[model samples]
Target: MILINRLRTVLAVTAVIVAPSGGTVLAAPSVPAPVSAAAQPTAPITLRYEANRRSMLAAGIDRPDGDFLLFDPNGRGRVAQVFGDLSTARRIAVLVPGMTNRLANFWRGVGGKSYRSPAVQAADLQRAGAGSGGFAVIAWLGYDTPQGFDEAGRANLARAGAAELERFVAGLVAVRPRATIALLGHSYGSVVIGHAAPRLPPQVTDIAVFGSAGMGVDDVAGLGTGARVWAGQSDQDWVRWVPAARLFGLGHGAKPAGPGFGARVFATADVHDHDHYLSPGTDSLAALARIAGDLP
Candidate 1:
Protein backbone atom coordinates (compact mmCIF):
# COMPACT_ATOMS: atom_id res chain seq x y z
CA MET A 1 0.00 0.00 0.00
CA ILE A 2 2.85 2.39 0.77
CA LEU A 3 4.53 1.62 -2.54
CA ILE A 4 1.28 2.21 -4.39
CA ASN A 5 0.80 5.55 -2.64
CA ARG A 6 4.29 6.66 -3.60
CA LEU A 7 3.64 5.74 -7.23
CA ARG A 8 0.43 7.75 -7.19
CA THR A 9 2.25 10.78 -5.77
CA VAL A 10 4.82 10.49 -8.52
CA LEU A 11 2.15 10.35 -11.17
CA ALA A 12 0.31 13.31 -9.72
CA VAL A 13 3.40 15.53 -9.63
CA THR A 14 4.44 14.40 -13.09
CA ALA A 15 1.28 15.64 -14.70
CA VAL A 16 1.62 19.12 -16.26
CA ILE A 17 -0.38 21.61 -14.24
CA VAL A 18 -3.49 22.97 -15.85
CA ALA A 19 -5.22 25.57 -13.69
CA PRO A 20 -8.56 26.49 -15.16
CA SER A 21 -9.81 30.06 -14.53
CA GLY A 22 -7.19 31.54 -16.96
CA GLY A 23 -4.12 30.78 -14.83
CA THR A 24 -2.33 27.47 -15.21
CA VAL A 25 -1.80 25.59 -18.48
CA LEU A 26 -2.58 21.99 -19.48
CA ALA A 27 -0.53 19.76 -21.73
CA ALA A 28 -1.02 16.67 -23.84
CA PRO A 29 0.23 13.44 -22.33
CA SER A 30 3.58 12.68 -23.92
CA VAL A 31 7.29 12.47 -23.07
CA PRO A 32 7.51 16.10 -24.12
CA ALA A 33 4.19 17.47 -23.15
CA PRO A 34 5.78 20.88 -22.87
CA VAL A 35 4.07 23.85 -21.33
CA SER A 36 4.62 27.09 -23.19
CA ALA A 37 6.54 29.82 -21.39
CA ALA A 38 4.55 32.77 -20.31
CA ALA A 39 5.84 36.19 -21.30
CA GLN A 40 8.45 37.54 -18.89
CA PRO A 41 9.10 41.20 -18.28
CA THR A 42 12.49 42.56 -19.32
CA ALA A 43 13.72 45.15 -16.90
CA PRO A 44 17.11 46.26 -15.59
CA ILE A 45 17.82 44.80 -12.17
CA THR A 46 20.69 45.73 -9.85
CA LEU A 47 22.94 43.64 -7.62
CA ARG A 48 24.26 44.10 -4.10
CA TYR A 49 27.98 43.45 -4.42
CA GLU A 50 29.25 46.02 -1.97
CA ALA A 51 29.11 44.00 1.24
CA ASN A 52 32.03 41.64 0.66
CA ARG A 53 33.72 43.13 -2.41
CA ARG A 54 35.88 45.58 -0.50
CA SER A 55 36.87 43.10 2.20
CA MET A 56 37.62 40.28 -0.27
CA LEU A 57 39.57 42.56 -2.61
CA ALA A 58 41.68 44.12 0.16
CA ALA A 59 42.81 40.59 0.97
CA GLY A 60 44.39 40.34 -2.55
CA ILE A 61 42.82 36.93 -3.17
CA ASP A 62 41.98 37.83 -6.74
CA ARG A 63 45.52 38.50 -8.00
CA PRO A 64 46.86 34.94 -7.82
CA ASP A 65 44.57 33.10 -10.25
CA GLY A 66 42.16 35.85 -11.17
CA ASP A 67 39.95 34.49 -8.43
CA PHE A 68 37.15 36.86 -7.66
CA LEU A 69 35.44 35.95 -4.42
CA LEU A 70 32.21 37.53 -5.40
CA PHE A 71 30.15 36.55 -2.40
CA ASP A 72 30.73 34.58 0.78
CA PRO A 73 28.69 34.85 3.93
CA ASN A 74 30.12 34.68 7.44
CA GLY A 75 28.13 31.70 8.72
CA ARG A 76 26.75 30.34 5.47
CA GLY A 77 28.35 28.07 2.88
CA ARG A 78 27.01 29.86 -0.18
CA VAL A 79 29.76 31.35 -2.34
CA ALA A 80 30.59 32.49 -5.86
CA GLN A 81 34.16 32.24 -7.10
CA VAL A 82 35.54 33.15 -10.52
CA PHE A 83 38.59 31.71 -12.28
CA GLY A 84 40.57 33.53 -14.99
CA ASP A 85 40.72 37.12 -16.23
CA LEU A 86 37.57 38.96 -15.29
CA SER A 87 38.86 42.47 -15.76
CA THR A 88 39.48 42.29 -19.53
CA ALA A 89 38.36 38.88 -20.69
CA ARG A 90 36.68 38.69 -24.05
CA ARG A 91 34.48 35.80 -22.95
CA ILE A 92 33.20 34.27 -19.71
CA ALA A 93 31.44 31.08 -18.75
CA VAL A 94 29.44 30.73 -15.56
CA LEU A 95 29.05 27.19 -14.21
CA VAL A 96 26.11 26.44 -11.93
CA PRO A 97 26.13 23.10 -10.16
CA GLY A 98 23.29 20.85 -9.07
CA MET A 99 22.69 19.19 -5.70
CA THR A 100 25.27 18.50 -2.94
CA ASN A 101 27.62 21.24 -4.17
CA ARG A 102 29.14 23.74 -1.77
CA LEU A 103 32.37 25.66 -1.20
CA ALA A 104 33.63 22.79 0.95
CA ASN A 105 33.29 20.28 -1.88
CA PHE A 106 34.12 22.66 -4.71
CA TRP A 107 37.38 20.84 -5.44
CA ARG A 108 38.73 17.37 -4.85
CA GLY A 109 42.33 16.16 -5.39
CA VAL A 110 42.16 12.65 -6.74
CA GLY A 111 45.76 12.43 -7.94
CA GLY A 112 46.91 15.99 -8.64
CA LYS A 113 43.76 17.84 -9.72
CA SER A 114 40.15 17.01 -9.01
CA TYR A 115 38.29 16.20 -12.19
CA ARG A 116 35.24 15.48 -10.04
CA SER A 117 34.98 19.10 -8.92
CA PRO A 118 33.02 22.02 -10.35
CA ALA A 119 36.08 24.26 -9.81
CA VAL A 120 38.14 21.96 -12.00
CA GLN A 121 35.42 21.95 -14.59
CA ALA A 122 35.66 25.73 -14.76
CA ALA A 123 39.45 25.58 -14.92
CA ASP A 124 39.33 23.04 -17.74
CA LEU A 125 36.92 25.21 -19.68
CA GLN A 126 39.27 28.17 -19.17
CA ARG A 127 42.13 26.11 -20.59
CA ALA A 128 40.10 24.93 -23.59
CA GLY A 129 38.94 28.45 -24.45
CA ALA A 130 42.14 30.34 -23.67
CA GLY A 131 43.55 29.78 -27.17
CA SER A 132 40.57 31.42 -28.81
CA GLY A 133 40.64 34.52 -26.63
CA GLY A 134 40.75 35.79 -23.10
CA PHE A 135 38.25 33.90 -20.98
CA ALA A 136 37.07 33.35 -17.42
CA VAL A 137 34.91 30.72 -15.72
CA ILE A 138 32.84 31.13 -12.59
CA ALA A 139 31.84 28.26 -10.31
CA TRP A 140 28.74 29.84 -8.92
CA LEU A 141 27.86 28.21 -5.61
CA GLY A 142 25.57 31.01 -4.56
CA TYR A 143 22.56 29.01 -3.46
CA ASP A 144 21.53 26.54 -0.79
CA THR A 145 21.34 23.40 -2.90
CA PRO A 146 19.47 20.29 -1.84
CA GLN A 147 21.07 16.89 -1.82
CA GLY A 148 20.01 14.07 -4.13
CA PHE A 149 16.77 12.26 -3.13
CA ASP A 150 16.38 14.70 -0.24
CA GLU A 151 13.11 15.92 1.14
CA ALA A 152 13.81 19.50 0.00
CA GLY A 153 13.94 18.52 -3.69
CA ARG A 154 11.51 21.11 -4.85
CA ALA A 155 11.45 24.36 -6.91
CA ASN A 156 11.60 26.95 -4.09
CA LEU A 157 15.36 26.65 -3.82
CA ALA A 158 15.67 27.07 -7.55
CA ARG A 159 13.32 30.05 -7.65
CA ALA A 160 15.29 31.88 -4.97
CA GLY A 161 18.62 30.87 -6.45
CA ALA A 162 17.52 32.20 -9.82
CA ALA A 163 17.30 35.74 -8.47
CA GLU A 164 20.77 35.53 -6.96
CA LEU A 165 22.17 34.17 -10.25
CA GLU A 166 20.73 37.08 -12.17
CA ARG A 167 22.29 39.48 -9.68
CA PHE A 168 25.63 37.77 -10.00
CA VAL A 169 25.51 37.99 -13.79
CA ALA A 170 24.65 41.64 -13.47
CA GLY A 171 27.71 42.14 -11.30
CA LEU A 172 29.90 40.29 -13.80
CA VAL A 173 28.65 42.37 -16.69
CA ALA A 174 29.24 45.50 -14.73
CA VAL A 175 32.92 44.59 -14.47
CA ARG A 176 33.48 43.17 -17.95
CA PRO A 177 31.22 45.16 -20.22
CA ARG A 178 31.97 43.82 -23.68
CA ALA A 179 32.60 40.17 -22.84
CA THR A 180 30.29 37.58 -24.35
CA ILE A 181 28.95 35.50 -21.49
CA ALA A 182 27.64 31.96 -21.50
CA LEU A 183 25.76 30.19 -18.71
CA LEU A 184 26.60 26.48 -18.27
CA GLY A 185 24.05 24.87 -15.99
CA HIS A 186 24.38 21.23 -14.96
CA SER A 187 21.65 19.03 -13.48
CA TYR A 188 19.37 21.00 -11.17
CA GLY A 189 21.32 24.14 -11.95
CA SER A 190 19.47 24.13 -15.25
CA VAL A 191 16.27 24.65 -13.32
CA VAL A 192 17.75 27.75 -11.64
CA ILE A 193 19.01 29.05 -14.95
CA GLY A 194 15.62 28.58 -16.54
CA HIS A 195 14.05 30.71 -13.86
CA ALA A 196 16.80 33.33 -14.27
CA ALA A 197 16.71 33.32 -18.10
CA PRO A 198 14.08 35.95 -18.75
CA ARG A 199 15.93 38.53 -16.66
CA LEU A 200 19.47 37.71 -17.82
CA PRO A 201 21.68 40.54 -18.98
CA PRO A 202 22.10 41.53 -22.63
CA GLN A 203 25.78 40.58 -22.70
CA VAL A 204 24.82 36.92 -22.19
CA THR A 205 25.06 35.25 -25.60
CA ASP A 206 24.35 31.66 -24.75
CA ILE A 207 22.73 29.39 -22.15
CA ALA A 208 23.69 25.71 -22.13
CA VAL A 209 22.02 23.13 -19.87
CA PHE A 210 23.25 19.53 -19.43
CA GLY A 211 21.89 16.64 -17.39
CA SER A 212 18.92 18.81 -16.58
CA ALA A 213 15.77 17.61 -14.82
CA GLY A 214 13.77 20.34 -16.53
CA MET A 215 14.11 24.08 -17.23
CA GLY A 216 10.79 25.21 -15.71
CA VAL A 217 9.43 25.79 -19.19
CA ASP A 218 8.34 23.80 -22.21
CA ASP A 219 10.72 25.05 -24.91
CA VAL A 220 13.56 27.46 -25.57
CA ALA A 221 11.12 30.14 -26.58
CA GLY A 222 9.76 30.02 -23.07
CA LEU A 223 13.14 31.07 -21.71
CA GLY A 224 12.50 34.59 -23.06
CA THR A 225 16.19 35.29 -23.39
CA GLY A 226 17.67 36.45 -26.69
CA ALA A 227 20.64 34.20 -25.99
CA ARG A 228 20.86 30.92 -27.86
CA VAL A 229 19.76 27.98 -25.70
CA TRP A 230 21.56 24.64 -25.81
CA ALA A 231 20.80 21.30 -24.14
CA GLY A 232 22.70 18.00 -23.83
CA GLN A 233 21.98 14.77 -22.01
CA SER A 234 23.91 11.55 -21.70
CA ASP A 235 21.96 8.36 -22.28
CA GLN A 236 22.97 6.85 -18.96
CA ASP A 237 22.03 9.84 -16.82
CA TRP A 238 19.55 8.96 -14.06
CA VAL A 239 17.94 12.43 -14.19
CA ARG A 240 16.13 11.30 -17.34
CA TRP A 241 13.83 9.29 -15.09
CA VAL A 242 12.62 12.33 -13.14
CA PRO A 243 9.13 13.20 -14.27
CA ALA A 244 8.87 16.62 -15.96
CA ALA A 245 5.97 18.58 -14.60
CA ARG A 246 5.14 21.82 -12.78
CA LEU A 247 2.15 20.55 -10.85
CA PHE A 248 2.33 21.88 -7.30
CA GLY A 249 5.74 23.22 -8.29
CA LEU A 250 6.96 19.79 -7.35
CA GLY A 251 9.14 19.42 -10.47
CA HIS A 252 10.55 21.62 -13.17
CA GLY A 253 8.29 22.29 -16.15
CA ALA A 254 9.62 20.35 -19.18
CA LYS A 255 12.68 18.38 -20.12
CA PRO A 256 15.05 20.60 -22.06
CA ALA A 257 16.39 17.72 -24.22
CA GLY A 258 13.07 16.00 -24.70
CA PRO A 259 11.33 16.20 -28.07
CA GLY A 260 9.89 19.68 -28.80
CA PHE A 261 11.99 21.24 -26.03
CA GLY A 262 13.35 23.44 -28.88
CA ALA A 263 16.94 23.68 -27.64
CA ARG A 264 19.99 23.20 -29.85
CA VAL A 265 20.88 19.58 -29.16
CA PHE A 266 24.58 19.03 -28.58
CA ALA A 267 26.42 15.74 -28.55
CA THR A 268 27.50 14.28 -25.22
CA ALA A 269 29.61 11.47 -26.64
CA ASP A 270 32.24 9.83 -24.42
CA VAL A 271 30.72 11.32 -21.31
CA HIS A 272 30.07 8.28 -19.18
CA ASP A 273 28.26 9.66 -16.16
CA HIS A 274 26.58 12.76 -14.78
CA ASP A 275 29.51 14.15 -12.74
CA HIS A 276 32.19 14.19 -15.47
CA TYR A 277 30.52 16.16 -18.23
CA LEU A 278 33.33 18.68 -18.01
CA SER A 279 36.04 16.06 -17.79
CA PRO A 280 38.85 16.59 -20.30
CA GLY A 281 38.95 14.95 -23.78
CA THR A 282 35.17 14.46 -23.86
CA ASP A 283 32.89 15.80 -26.58
CA SER A 284 30.70 17.47 -23.98
CA LEU A 285 33.67 19.39 -22.66
CA ALA A 286 34.76 20.36 -26.14
CA ALA A 287 31.33 21.62 -27.07
CA LEU A 288 31.10 23.63 -23.83
CA ALA A 289 34.55 25.03 -24.52
CA ARG A 290 33.47 26.24 -27.92
CA ILE A 291 30.43 27.92 -26.49
CA ALA A 292 32.45 29.57 -23.72
CA GLY A 293 35.07 30.76 -26.19
CA ASP A 294 32.46 32.01 -28.65
CA LEU A 295 34.24 30.08 -31.36
CA PRO A 296 32.82 29.28 -34.79
Candidate 2:
Protein backbone atom coordinates (compact mmCIF):
# COMPACT_ATOMS: atom_id res chain seq x y z
CA MET A 1 0.00 0.00 0.00
CA ILE A 2 2.91 2.39 0.80
CA LEU A 3 4.61 1.61 -2.51
CA ILE A 4 1.38 2.26 -4.42
CA ASN A 5 0.94 5.59 -2.65
CA ARG A 6 4.57 6.65 -3.49
CA LEU A 7 4.01 5.89 -7.22
CA ARG A 8 0.81 7.98 -7.23
CA THR A 9 2.65 10.89 -5.56
CA VAL A 10 5.44 10.80 -8.20
CA LEU A 11 2.95 10.93 -11.14
CA ALA A 12 1.01 13.76 -9.49
CA VAL A 13 4.24 15.78 -9.00
CA THR A 14 5.29 15.22 -12.64
CA ALA A 15 1.87 16.33 -13.92
CA VAL A 16 2.05 19.54 -11.90
CA ILE A 17 5.62 20.28 -13.05
CA VAL A 18 4.69 19.98 -16.76
CA ALA A 19 1.44 21.98 -16.37
CA PRO A 20 0.87 24.98 -18.73
CA SER A 21 2.08 28.45 -17.63
CA GLY A 22 -1.45 29.82 -16.82
CA GLY A 23 -2.47 26.89 -14.65
CA THR A 24 -3.53 27.50 -11.06
CA VAL A 25 -0.81 25.31 -9.60
CA LEU A 26 2.72 26.75 -9.74
CA ALA A 27 5.00 24.60 -11.89
CA ALA A 28 8.63 24.46 -13.11
CA PRO A 29 9.32 25.86 -16.58
CA SER A 30 9.96 23.46 -19.51
CA VAL A 31 13.52 23.34 -20.93
CA PRO A 32 13.83 25.10 -24.27
CA ALA A 33 14.25 22.81 -27.30
CA PRO A 34 17.31 23.20 -29.56
CA VAL A 35 16.73 25.47 -32.55
CA SER A 36 16.79 24.26 -36.18
CA ALA A 37 19.75 24.23 -38.67
CA ALA A 38 19.99 28.02 -38.96
CA ALA A 39 22.00 28.48 -35.74
CA GLN A 40 25.49 26.87 -35.46
CA PRO A 41 29.00 28.29 -35.36
CA THR A 42 30.86 28.17 -38.65
CA ALA A 43 33.83 25.88 -39.21
CA PRO A 44 37.14 27.68 -39.70
CA ILE A 45 38.57 27.83 -43.18
CA THR A 46 41.67 25.71 -43.53
CA LEU A 47 43.11 26.01 -47.06
CA ARG A 48 41.86 28.85 -49.18
CA TYR A 49 43.31 31.33 -51.70
CA GLU A 50 42.02 34.29 -49.71
CA ALA A 51 44.90 34.05 -47.24
CA ASN A 52 47.39 34.28 -50.11
CA ARG A 53 45.57 37.11 -51.82
CA ARG A 54 45.12 39.03 -48.57
CA SER A 55 48.82 38.75 -47.84
CA MET A 56 49.66 40.00 -51.30
CA LEU A 57 47.38 42.99 -51.04
CA ALA A 58 48.60 43.84 -47.56
CA ALA A 59 52.15 43.91 -48.90
CA GLY A 60 50.98 46.45 -51.51
CA ILE A 61 51.33 44.12 -54.49
CA ASP A 62 48.47 44.60 -56.90
CA ARG A 63 49.54 42.70 -60.01
CA PRO A 64 52.44 41.58 -62.19
CA ASP A 65 54.11 43.68 -64.90
CA GLY A 66 53.66 43.85 -68.68
CA ASP A 67 52.92 40.54 -70.47
CA PHE A 68 53.04 38.69 -67.17
CA LEU A 69 49.73 40.13 -66.02
CA LEU A 70 47.52 37.85 -68.06
CA PHE A 71 46.04 34.87 -66.20
CA ASP A 72 46.91 31.70 -68.10
CA PRO A 73 44.56 28.75 -68.67
CA ASN A 74 46.34 26.80 -65.93
CA GLY A 75 44.95 29.36 -63.47
CA ARG A 76 48.43 30.65 -62.93
CA GLY A 77 48.77 34.37 -63.48
CA ARG A 78 51.38 35.78 -65.79
CA VAL A 79 54.82 36.98 -64.74
CA ALA A 80 53.10 39.45 -62.46
CA GLN A 81 52.22 36.46 -60.30
CA VAL A 82 55.92 35.79 -59.94
CA PHE A 83 57.06 39.36 -59.21
CA GLY A 84 54.61 41.00 -56.82
CA ASP A 85 54.29 44.75 -56.29
CA LEU A 86 56.81 46.59 -54.07
CA SER A 87 55.20 49.84 -53.06
CA THR A 88 55.38 51.39 -49.57
CA ALA A 89 57.33 48.64 -47.89
CA ARG A 90 60.10 49.66 -45.47
CA ARG A 91 61.80 46.24 -45.64
CA ILE A 92 61.56 43.47 -48.27
CA ALA A 93 62.92 39.95 -48.53
CA VAL A 94 63.56 38.22 -51.85
CA LEU A 95 63.55 34.49 -51.10
CA VAL A 96 65.28 32.51 -53.86
CA PRO A 97 65.16 28.71 -54.00
CA GLY A 98 67.44 26.11 -55.65
CA MET A 99 67.25 23.13 -58.06
CA THR A 100 63.93 21.88 -59.47
CA ASN A 101 62.12 24.53 -57.48
CA ARG A 102 59.27 26.32 -59.14
CA LEU A 103 56.81 28.72 -57.54
CA ALA A 104 55.23 25.81 -55.64
CA ASN A 105 58.40 24.32 -54.16
CA PHE A 106 58.67 26.73 -51.25
CA TRP A 107 55.59 25.29 -49.55
CA ARG A 108 57.17 21.98 -48.56
CA GLY A 109 57.08 21.10 -44.84
CA VAL A 110 58.10 18.21 -42.60
CA GLY A 111 55.89 15.13 -41.89
CA GLY A 112 53.23 16.40 -44.29
CA LYS A 113 52.25 19.36 -42.18
CA SER A 114 50.52 22.32 -43.79
CA TYR A 115 52.82 25.25 -44.47
CA ARG A 116 52.74 28.35 -46.66
CA SER A 117 54.99 29.17 -49.57
CA PRO A 118 57.40 32.09 -50.07
CA ALA A 119 54.31 34.16 -50.57
CA VAL A 120 53.47 32.86 -47.12
CA GLN A 121 57.00 33.69 -46.13
CA ALA A 122 56.35 37.24 -47.19
CA ALA A 123 53.10 37.23 -45.24
CA ASP A 124 54.90 35.89 -42.18
CA LEU A 125 57.38 38.74 -42.35
CA GLN A 126 54.40 41.05 -42.49
CA ARG A 127 52.89 39.29 -39.48
CA ALA A 128 56.18 39.54 -37.65
CA GLY A 129 56.29 43.14 -38.74
CA ALA A 130 52.81 43.79 -37.39
CA GLY A 131 54.12 42.93 -33.93
CA SER A 132 57.47 44.77 -34.07
CA GLY A 133 56.30 46.97 -36.95
CA GLY A 134 58.99 47.51 -39.63
CA PHE A 135 59.35 45.05 -42.52
CA ALA A 136 57.83 43.31 -45.59
CA VAL A 137 58.89 40.25 -47.61
CA ILE A 138 58.48 38.77 -51.11
CA ALA A 139 58.97 35.31 -52.49
CA TRP A 140 61.04 35.77 -55.66
CA LEU A 141 61.19 32.89 -58.17
CA GLY A 142 61.07 35.17 -61.17
CA TYR A 143 63.90 33.71 -63.24
CA ASP A 144 64.52 31.09 -65.92
CA THR A 145 65.45 28.38 -63.45
CA PRO A 146 66.87 24.97 -64.29
CA GLN A 147 64.79 21.87 -63.63
CA GLY A 148 67.46 19.57 -62.22
CA PHE A 149 70.91 19.51 -60.61
CA ASP A 150 73.03 17.65 -63.16
CA GLU A 151 76.51 19.26 -62.98
CA ALA A 152 76.44 20.75 -66.48
CA GLY A 153 72.80 21.75 -66.23
CA ARG A 154 73.30 23.60 -62.94
CA ALA A 155 76.33 25.49 -64.24
CA ASN A 156 74.40 26.75 -67.25
CA LEU A 157 71.43 27.77 -65.13
CA ALA A 158 73.74 29.66 -62.79
CA ARG A 159 75.09 31.90 -65.53
CA ALA A 160 71.78 32.40 -67.30
CA GLY A 161 69.76 32.84 -64.12
CA ALA A 162 72.15 35.49 -62.85
CA ALA A 163 71.31 37.78 -65.75
CA GLU A 164 67.60 37.26 -65.15
CA LEU A 165 68.05 37.98 -61.45
CA GLU A 166 69.83 41.21 -62.25
CA ARG A 167 66.99 42.21 -64.52
CA PHE A 168 64.39 41.41 -61.85
CA VAL A 169 66.15 43.65 -59.38
CA ALA A 170 66.39 46.42 -61.92
CA GLY A 171 62.69 46.16 -62.71
CA LEU A 172 61.72 46.14 -59.03
CA VAL A 173 63.71 49.31 -58.43
CA ALA A 174 62.18 51.04 -61.39
CA VAL A 175 58.93 51.17 -59.44
CA ARG A 176 59.78 51.24 -55.73
CA PRO A 177 62.90 53.38 -55.69
CA ARG A 178 63.34 53.52 -51.93
CA ALA A 179 62.22 50.11 -50.71
CA THR A 180 65.03 48.16 -49.03
CA ILE A 181 65.22 44.56 -50.29
CA ALA A 182 67.19 41.72 -48.77
CA LEU A 183 68.30 38.84 -51.02
CA LEU A 184 67.86 35.50 -49.24
CA GLY A 185 69.11 32.41 -51.07
CA HIS A 186 68.68 28.74 -50.23
CA SER A 187 71.05 25.98 -51.46
CA TYR A 188 71.91 26.66 -55.11
CA GLY A 189 69.78 29.74 -54.79
CA SER A 190 72.68 31.13 -52.81
CA VAL A 191 74.85 30.90 -55.90
CA VAL A 192 72.30 32.85 -57.89
CA ILE A 193 72.22 35.63 -55.28
CA GLY A 194 76.02 35.67 -55.02
CA HIS A 195 76.40 36.10 -58.76
CA ALA A 196 73.74 38.80 -59.01
CA ALA A 197 74.65 40.61 -55.78
CA PRO A 198 77.30 42.76 -57.40
CA ARG A 199 74.95 43.91 -60.12
CA LEU A 200 71.82 44.62 -58.02
CA PRO A 201 70.59 48.11 -57.21
CA PRO A 202 71.96 49.96 -54.18
CA GLN A 203 68.61 49.60 -52.45
CA VAL A 204 69.35 46.01 -51.50
CA THR A 205 70.16 46.03 -47.78
CA ASP A 206 71.55 42.55 -47.23
CA ILE A 207 72.47 39.21 -48.80
CA ALA A 208 71.77 36.08 -46.74
CA VAL A 209 72.32 32.39 -47.57
CA PHE A 210 70.97 29.24 -45.94
CA GLY A 211 71.97 25.57 -46.53
CA SER A 212 74.49 26.69 -49.13
CA ALA A 213 77.21 24.57 -50.68
CA GLY A 214 79.46 27.58 -51.23
CA MET A 215 78.98 31.20 -52.29
CA GLY A 216 81.74 31.62 -54.90
CA VAL A 217 83.87 33.88 -52.74
CA ASP A 218 87.40 33.94 -51.42
CA ASP A 219 86.42 36.29 -48.58
CA VAL A 220 83.50 38.35 -47.34
CA ALA A 221 84.87 41.55 -48.85
CA GLY A 222 84.70 40.11 -52.35
CA LEU A 223 80.90 40.04 -52.50
CA GLY A 224 80.23 42.89 -54.88
CA THR A 225 76.78 43.68 -53.51
CA GLY A 226 77.03 46.71 -51.20
CA ALA A 227 74.57 45.22 -48.71
CA ARG A 228 75.45 43.57 -45.44
CA VAL A 229 76.10 39.86 -46.12
CA TRP A 230 75.03 37.04 -43.76
CA ALA A 231 75.08 33.21 -43.84
CA GLY A 232 73.38 30.43 -41.86
CA GLN A 233 74.33 26.76 -42.19
CA SER A 234 73.25 23.98 -39.86
CA ASP A 235 75.84 21.58 -38.42
CA GLN A 236 74.11 18.55 -39.93
CA ASP A 237 73.72 20.17 -43.33
CA TRP A 238 74.92 17.91 -46.13
CA VAL A 239 76.28 20.97 -47.90
CA ARG A 240 78.93 21.30 -45.22
CA TRP A 241 80.11 17.77 -46.00
CA VAL A 242 80.10 18.15 -49.80
CA PRO A 243 83.53 17.50 -51.32
CA ALA A 244 85.32 20.77 -52.03
CA ALA A 245 87.29 19.02 -54.76
CA ARG A 246 84.15 18.70 -56.87
CA LEU A 247 83.75 22.48 -56.88
CA PHE A 248 87.41 23.32 -57.52
CA GLY A 249 87.97 22.51 -61.19
CA LEU A 250 86.80 25.25 -63.58
CA GLY A 251 83.43 25.30 -61.89
CA HIS A 252 81.07 28.04 -60.66
CA GLY A 253 81.38 26.97 -57.02
CA ALA A 254 83.53 29.25 -54.84
CA LYS A 255 84.17 29.44 -51.12
CA PRO A 256 81.96 32.18 -49.67
CA ALA A 257 84.62 33.18 -47.13
CA GLY A 258 87.86 32.29 -48.88
CA PRO A 259 89.07 35.83 -49.48
CA GLY A 260 86.84 38.54 -50.92
CA PHE A 261 83.30 37.38 -50.16
CA GLY A 262 81.91 39.49 -47.31
CA ALA A 263 79.45 37.51 -45.17
CA ARG A 264 78.94 37.21 -41.41
CA VAL A 265 78.49 33.49 -40.78
CA PHE A 266 75.82 32.69 -38.18
CA ALA A 267 76.64 29.54 -36.19
CA THR A 268 74.25 26.57 -36.55
CA ALA A 269 74.39 24.97 -33.13
CA ASP A 270 70.56 25.06 -32.92
CA VAL A 271 69.55 24.29 -36.50
CA HIS A 272 68.65 20.77 -37.56
CA ASP A 273 68.09 19.58 -41.16
CA HIS A 274 68.92 21.45 -44.36
CA ASP A 275 65.51 23.12 -44.64
CA HIS A 276 64.95 23.98 -40.98
CA TYR A 277 66.87 27.24 -41.09
CA LEU A 278 63.67 29.23 -41.35
CA SER A 279 61.56 27.04 -39.10
CA PRO A 280 60.26 28.55 -35.88
CA GLY A 281 62.42 28.07 -32.76
CA THR A 282 65.64 27.24 -34.62
CA ASP A 283 68.78 29.24 -33.89
CA SER A 284 69.69 29.73 -37.54
CA LEU A 285 66.23 31.12 -38.22
CA ALA A 286 66.52 33.40 -35.21
CA ALA A 287 69.78 34.73 -36.59
CA LEU A 288 68.11 35.21 -39.95
CA ALA A 289 65.26 37.11 -38.24
CA ARG A 290 67.86 39.38 -36.65
CA ILE A 291 69.58 39.88 -39.99
CA ALA A 292 66.20 40.49 -41.59
CA GLY A 293 65.47 42.77 -38.60
CA ASP A 294 62.49 40.68 -37.40
CA LEU A 295 61.51 39.87 -33.81
CA PRO A 296 62.08 36.67 -31.75
lDDT on C-alpha atoms for all candidate structures = 0.72, 0.53
Write down the lDDT that model 1 would get: 0.72
Q: TM-scores of the models, in the given order?
A: 0.75, 0.63
lDDT string, candidate 1, 74-187, tens digits: 333555556776666888899998877765566662233477577778888888877655887888888877765552358888898899888878766765778889999998
Worst 10 residues of 2 by lDDT: 37-46
lDDT of 2 by residue, 149-230 (tens): 5642245566666776777666557555676777788777787887777788898888888777665555555566678888
Candidate 1: the clashing residue pairs are none
Best by TM-score: 1
Candidate 1 Cα deviation (angstroms), residue 203: 0.9
Candidate 2 deviant stretches above 4 angstroms: 1-85, 104-116, 129-131, 151-153, 245-251, 257-262, 294-296
